[model samples]
Target: MVNKKPSSQPYNLLPEAAQTLLALMHAQGEVARLSEREQLFSSLLDSVNAVLWAFDWESRQVLYVSPAYERIFGRPAGLLLADFNEWRDSIYPDDLDYAERSLAEVLVKGAVEDREYRIIAADGKIRWLSDKCFINQQTDNNQRVIIVGMAEDITEKKQLEGELQRLATTDALTQSSNRRHFFDCAHHAFATARLDQAPLTFLLLDIDDFKQINDTYGHQEGDYVLQRIADTGKAVLRRGDLFGRIGGEEFAAVFPGCTPQIAQQIAERLQREIQRLSFSHEHQTFGVTVSQGLTGITDADESLDSLFARADAAMYQAKRQGKNQIVSG
Candidate 1:
């Protein structure tokens, strides 16, 4: 019997050659499809503006980061993939704790959709981000935990919100708190003072003969006078005190934790500041005076409205007796 060596060429192995060739062809086709799929995904990731990332929870490793990561974060994606701490380092110092803690919550909650935070970019500019993250549980029966997230820049949205808030709460002409915002704040302070039995003072001021000034100097000069008086009030008020423009020529201030004596002194200083502000129009320089009504918290005072009423009466009394003076109610 002749013992022949097995043929090295696959085709010579007649019995199994067909199966082997078919398997090889199928594998080649699958490889090509996989390559095309990967390229398609890479293109899609790069086209977007949000940063997409995947992390391995068990090893604390960054498994993948999309091209948008570098563009949005202003840092190299390679650094983040190499060390997860690079992502953590980019978070704003004040938001670092909340960012980390909220991310960890995804493990229990399965998803976190409303995570918004601030980050310091490579250029030393602050950018706001709305980051959403979720746990990937479809692989291997969740034996290994993975986190997937997309972070989008929302700086413009945040800025718009801030501007809208300022517009709503601020007086455009004088740059002071508007009437509504002032009353809201004063009401809150009044409640707090009543609860704590703390001292609080309220001052109501009106420009002396403001209508006459407008008639004599024109509305533009009247506006200038209003701005200067507002500036004086802002300068003279102590920190934690609230000042606002409540009417055309009327401003109100709330001095939290102030005694009657201290509030009187503050009002006097504000009057002096206004007197020093001299405005020239049509070859004549004129100064302004503010008639102020000062009132302090009393056991009989039930609400901020009561304080305002007494202050209002005292201010009218100052006007009648002779303007440019402070009357305590």
Candidate 2:
């Protein structure tokens, strides 16, 4: 048995002190966990090659920026966070409106994914970036937070896609519209002509004595002649006309809203233009000539194939008659 002395403090006070100490220890543990998490996040920021950032909805101010900004854009992360307008102004002018509209759409929709834009770097280089982001609302419901978005460079990919599209629609030799592209435009023109009851004409042209020229001057000279013919033909045609290299030594033109008489005149003019062109290669100078076949759209019952066949027959007639003239069908 122990002798007990009367104490002023209640027994509950001792338990409360112990509880406070435990609570303090738990808080310290949480701080340590948070510190470790921050360090991990920083490491992640440094490892990526893309720009990662977050912002506030109301101020449109950047709240966080990843270390990758320095590596890719040649600017410190702090500069971007200090003034987001600097970043906005640095964007390519052509892409600025699109970028702003996309951001606004995302803010309204509460999320944005796979938006692409072009940003100017500190080194004065334009870079295409693809961004993905999420929106977070504040607990008090008065403000909104935008989560960190990652932006990856995609300039090279976009350029390659553009080049591929150009190649698909362009002729490799003449640098004009290809056969398929020509047909596509012709189809549209045909549809329009049928709707408006307008006349449409086609000219099928063949290089007169092309094989003989190739045999005499070599294939290189033949190619030069063909290119010159294409150039001259384009120069003489109107803006609305479509011309294309359809075959080895054959070309075609689609003239929309042209009657049979006008088509005949155009074919004759093209024939004269080709005859007037004087080409020289390796000390040899010679004039080029072409035979053209003209056909006009008469009725809705006419098909593109049938019209083309008539033009081809007329061209063959020109070839049979002389080899440097226009035949109308």
Candidate 3:
């Protein structure tokens, strides 16, 4: 009975306490690993150049959006996530209807891949996007319908395609339609006129003694004259009229739904405009004139070639008559 029984020190833990402590340590380690994995996934999304998004269709709420949303759209991701209308408002006014309709189509079609449209960014710059979307047909545990999509910035690609089209269809020196493109359009117009039984006029014009000017003032000055004449033609022609430089010193025009009398009036206007243009080379000042041949579509005409032949012959007639006049065929 020393009565030292159960010393004042706390008692040691039982076997059950040790097991609980080890279990708690294991859970903490797992949580740390999960957090690191989550961070890695988010970093990957931020590096991408396209916007990836997930939406809860039933709730009309944005579920998630990648970091690229801010860069391409020039708007904050938080704003878009808070209000889906932020996206609808960014669409170009003219394309808004099509963009919304096409997006809705994804619900029925399962996926949409060819959805290209324009958007006005926050910075007031216009951008083009090739947005593709897919619908997950199955509902989640919460009965939420989700729509997933990716939008890529294709503005540079669109611009390159436009430039290539211009190079293919336009003359570099005069900035007018080239011969090949002009004939292509003219052929289409001729067929339409024939089918609709509409009146169409064709005019062929040649600069008077253009070679003499080129030889006198050199090719550079000759190019300047050609450019000015082309500009005048563009300015005088009706909106629907097609004008082009068809040869070195020859240009042509097609007037759809125009009678020969009205076409003559337009030709006279073009003539006056050209006459008003004066050029100087060295110490000499001079002016140039044009000889034109006019023809109209006829019941017997079979193709554009017939119209071309008549107009060419008539143009030569103008050349023979005076060199500065119009001849009708």
After superposition on all C-alphas, the RMSD of every candidate to the true structure, in Å, is 6.6, 6.8, 6.0
Tell me, by TM-score, which candidate is best.
3
| Candidate 3 lDDT, 258-282, residue by residue in tens | 9999999999999999999999988
Q: What's each prediction's clash count?
A: 0, 0, 0
TM-scores, all models, native as reference: 0.87, 0.72, 0.90
Q: Write the per-residue lDDT of candidate 2 for residues 68-126, one digit (tens) a residue.
A: 77776777777788888876887789999988888777667777886998888888888
- Candidate 2 stretches with Cα past 4 Å from truth are 1-47, 67-97, 117-127, 145-148, 195-199, 256-269, 301-303
Q: RMSD of model 1, in Å? A: 6.6
Better of 2 and 3 by lDDT: 3
Which stretch of 10 consecutive residues in model 1 shows the poorest summed lDDT? 6-15
Question: lDDT for each of the candidates?
Answer: 0.93, 0.84, 0.93
Over 4 Å off, model 3? 1-29, 141-143
lDDT of 1 at 198: 98
